[model samples]
Target chain A: MKPVIEIESISKKFLIPASSQGYQTLRESLTSLDFLRKKREFWALRDISFSMEQGETMGVIGNNGAGKTTLLKILSRITKPTSGKGRINARVASLLEVGTGFHPELTGRENIYLNGVILGLKKREIDRHFDEIVEFAGVKEFLNTPIKHYSTGMWARLAFSVAAHLDPEILLVDEVLSVGDAEFQKKSLVKMNDLSKNGRTVIFVSHNLAAVRQLCSRCMLISQGEITSIGNVNDVITEYTSFRDGDSPGTTDLTLISERKGSGIVRLTRIELRNSDEQVKGTFLMRDDLHIHLWLEAPVKVRNVKIVVDILNSFGETITSMFDSDSGFGLIEVEGSEHISITINDIRFYPGKYNISVSVISQILNHKYESFDEIENAITFDVENQLVNRNLTRRTGLLFLTPDWQIHKD
Target chain B: MAGYEIKPSGWLTFDFRELWHFRELFLFMTWRDIKVKYKQTFLGLAWVVLQPLALMAIFTVIWLKVMKPAELDIPYPLFAYSGLVFWGLFSSGISGAGESMISNANIIKKIYFPRIIIPASAALTALFDFVVTLFLLVLLILYYQIDVSLPRFAGLFSLSIMITMAASFGIGLIVSAATIRYRDFRYVMPFFLQAFFFVSPVVYPLALLSSDSLRIVLSLNPLAGAVTLARAAITGNPANWQAIFPGTLMTVFLLVAGLTLFRRNESSYSDLL
Candidate 1:
């Protein structure tokens, strides 16, 4: 079979303004339209080249901001590259996100046809698959109801349903199969697997490595806008897990982190992750003793102060929240400079990247949770598999658990 | 399903075939806009009729009573309604196209279709509203006992659509594309359309202008040509094709310029959005 997709040195450049009102207003652009001419240039994608054969499901594995989405966007023809070209010997359909063009005011049925057409399916094809989409989404009863009234899960299911039913020569999917409920996610995965089984070319980009492994015959690893490795799925994933030492930052200076907002009763100076021997580290194995160190300076004595640390997965979805008190576990009062190290005994996160976010809150003025300081995605680390048969090929899902299993004959 | 190629950004890459493939999406987007524009309102599609009908009624009374016409053989309401029909098309098309990019930013960022589809469909939705009002214009013509040749009326009607759509699409294309890169174009559109209304012969006659230079200057506005064409078609009045020629020429220029600008900026929409 011929290669369905062939790329040659594709790259994308973006002009980030040095400073402005964020969006280019008419007044500013009228006065200085050329202000971005001498601005800092960012290469979101850099000279990327790859090729894929027909019926091959290629998995794209990369760290956050590794140009995975940029690659997909280039392939999908949403954005043009600064240089280079790609030749595709198949009709391409890309689902960068579910419900990419769904109208909230329209009913579910209308959205299916609308989104289906937007995804490059013909109106007759949508009419042919109309019943199947309704059945798959399990929203047949609410098909006539506007999508805005549907629950988030229902919305997601219907969106996925329309895209899952698409029959294209090649499909470029990005991080969509990983979303939705577990049961629905499994169904979507099975649909994707079927698509490849029918000899359709698929390029899947997902943070959920397990889904990628299940659906992709080959895997590609991209780091810092370049392909570091591409070949067998197992080999690439192993390389990905091993190449994380320098990628995750161990020490994060929080004072300089601008992604924070608060009323300022306290100031967070720094945050650090430490291993069992009190050595600063970013990569940790499952069931390891993880200590979160927080350095803070308080101006006044704060009463009923509670600190919450959120552990988020690679997609920035909160996996777990650890705190001094979830509900009245005794809020502590603090004044002046203080250092607190919260030790998580036998942390059980599965193999993946994770980020830490901290929130300092106090119940000030009649039971209102007033925030003193907060920062998100400030510190990040990688979790390596730490068990027998420790293959990183399958990301296995978050929160590694050792539930006792017993078999009984009925 | 055959093959395709992704090339570097060109000076102009207006793919007509790709736009044709997205025809269903165009229809749906236009229908979607029409459905959503009046969704959850007390009078949904009725507003399509009520708006123009009310405007024509108010303008007819004011024109005859307050600002009396210098020379008019035809009924005032018929004359007023004919101009309102196409004027609605121009105003809605410009505003619709101007805001189409911003309103569909989410879709533009996620999916890949010709970016022109959004503004073009928005213009079509405006045309849909105008079509509804055309029924009223027909009734006004018959009510006023105007003589309209069936053969000539059809050609004029189609010409009026082409000019109005071309003018709106031409200017709207630029407004919509410019709005994406520089949001100032968003504010400029409403002000431009408001000013354009005074220049067009919407509620008044071009003949009333005593100065030949002023009449020619006003006729250069594309809507003036469309309105004049539409009025002549419905009432069987003689049309000055010369006065309408420059505006028609400007319409073609704007459309070409608009398409060039839109196609140049189309690939960067997802990045900027």
Candidate 2:
């Protein structure tokens, strides 16, 4: 079977300026235009390709500003791509935004006909399905009233019903379905599922991972304007989640964006905190081992240096302190560059925001303890209380690790 | 519904058959515009008649009573009102259509339909008002005891002239396309319309100009000859078939050129808007 939408080597490029702020001015605006031209280049979608067959439901998951909407707009024929080509062999319908084709002074009944024509439906076809469309919208009572008189929810309902009932062969849904209430959202999802079950192709774009997992049989992960992974829904979502968490603020490329400070003699070049499975994380359970991997660079030789990990709460209060020298942990001499690993097992912190403060000290001769460099609130994370059993129980205190439970019923 | 024949040639071509297929949509859009225009209007359709009537009264008083340069023994009100009807159709239709895309930018961005329907329907809405004023012209002409050549065919002849003037103003297509990106045209169009209203012989007759140079310059404006001929049609004067023929040809040329340019820019309107 041939793919219903054959998108081959489809790359969309945009001429976006480095400084694209829409400013209204004279001299500064001219200067900014000069700056824009100097730092602008073609932002290519980059050697990418994808195709989908009929009845296939594919979900596109990506970060913000990752060209997901641009790809969808090109497929919808709302905008032409700067390069590459694609073909769609289906009656495509799109609901990128609500209240799109509505006239303010026109009634709901009038707008439905107007939108029907906009969607390429003939007058006879609209008349045939008119009643069903109106009934689905739930605005039958306000059918003849001007749309401006209707509330926002009523407008959204009518807009959704018109696009939904049109029943195009392919549906391109953007993140606009979240406008309605939960019940309507459920109805719309059911409508989409029904469309897919009836051998219609659906391309859904959304940020909600759970919805994508529940609805899409195949999903693609987009990162930095490139398709990173595709295929099995679970594997793709897992890869996406890892990609998102691994790029969290303090974990990714800390050398250029580290919150720590140091003299030029030695600096915190890199840091990675991972779980037991070797997966980098920014969020963790309260009792998990907070294994920290640090890469430090020293310009000159240093000996007998101590490291400290300070845990602070959301209000900047230092809750606990774990010092390497205090625990009598042995330290080796470093000449230029060295790696250090610190594992604090069974962390017992309350449910709130916390940061790690790393410090280095020296035990040198003729001097007691000399401070090398100290940093505050470098890594931040959130903790959630463990909800083990729901027996209407309220457990107190931060430490609930390795709970000992016994029950006897005779 | 999905399959369509892609044009073999890369250049765009007019699809008159597709337009005919969507005739119902055109009619519906025109009806919607007409309804919303006078929905809560206090005077309703009477405002249409009152607009040209008031303009004729002012022109009659100012040009006849105040200026009184040269008269060919014609009723001042009839001459001025006739010119007002044709001029109103041209100015109001074109200007209304010129602002249609920007004013209705919401509808333009979302849907994929023949974008020409927007400006075309706006032009038609103004045409409806022009028709109401034509009814007043009929009453005024008969009341004034003006003689006509075959009064039965007078209305049909006037409609042909009115439509010609409307087509002349079909330059709105070009204006609408340009206004999407520049937006400077929106500010300039009203003053341009005002200047055109005077230069088109709406307030004065063609005979008022004694110089050959001025008459030749005025004839170059499509509406100047058309309006003069339409006035001659109602007043039983010898219709200047010479001037009317060339004027009609120019109006059609403008209409065709305007629509062609508009179609070229229609597909990219969303990006520019």
The residue ranges of model 1 lying beyond 4 angstroms of the native Cα positions read A20-22, A243-271, A275-289, A294-341, A345-410
Residue A99, candidate 2: C-alpha displacement in angstroms? 2.9
DockQ result, candidate 2: 0.15
Which tens-of-lDDT digit does each residue in A1-410 have in candidate 1?
A: 67889999988887876553446776665677766556778787888888998899999987656788988988988888988898999888999999988888899998998888888888998999999989988998998999999998999999998898788899999988766788888888888999999999999998676677678899998876788889998788667644234334678777765435576678788889999999999889888999999998888888777788888765435788877765445447778988988888898887887878788887546757788888765577788885948665334566678899999999
Positional deviation of residue B138's Cα in model 1 after best superposition, in angstroms: 1.3
Q: Quick one: best TM-score, which candidate?
A: 1
Candidate with best lDDT: 1
lDDT of the candidates, in the order given: 0.83, 0.71
Q: Candidate 1, after superposition: displacement of residue B115 in Å?
A: 1.6
lDDT of 2 by residue, B102-148 (tens): 87777666555567888988888877888888888878878987776
Model 2 CA lDDT for position A185: 76
Each prediction's DockQ? 0.68, 0.15
> Across residues A104-153, which tens digit of lDDT does each residue of candidate 2 receive?
88888988887776665677888988998889888999999989998878
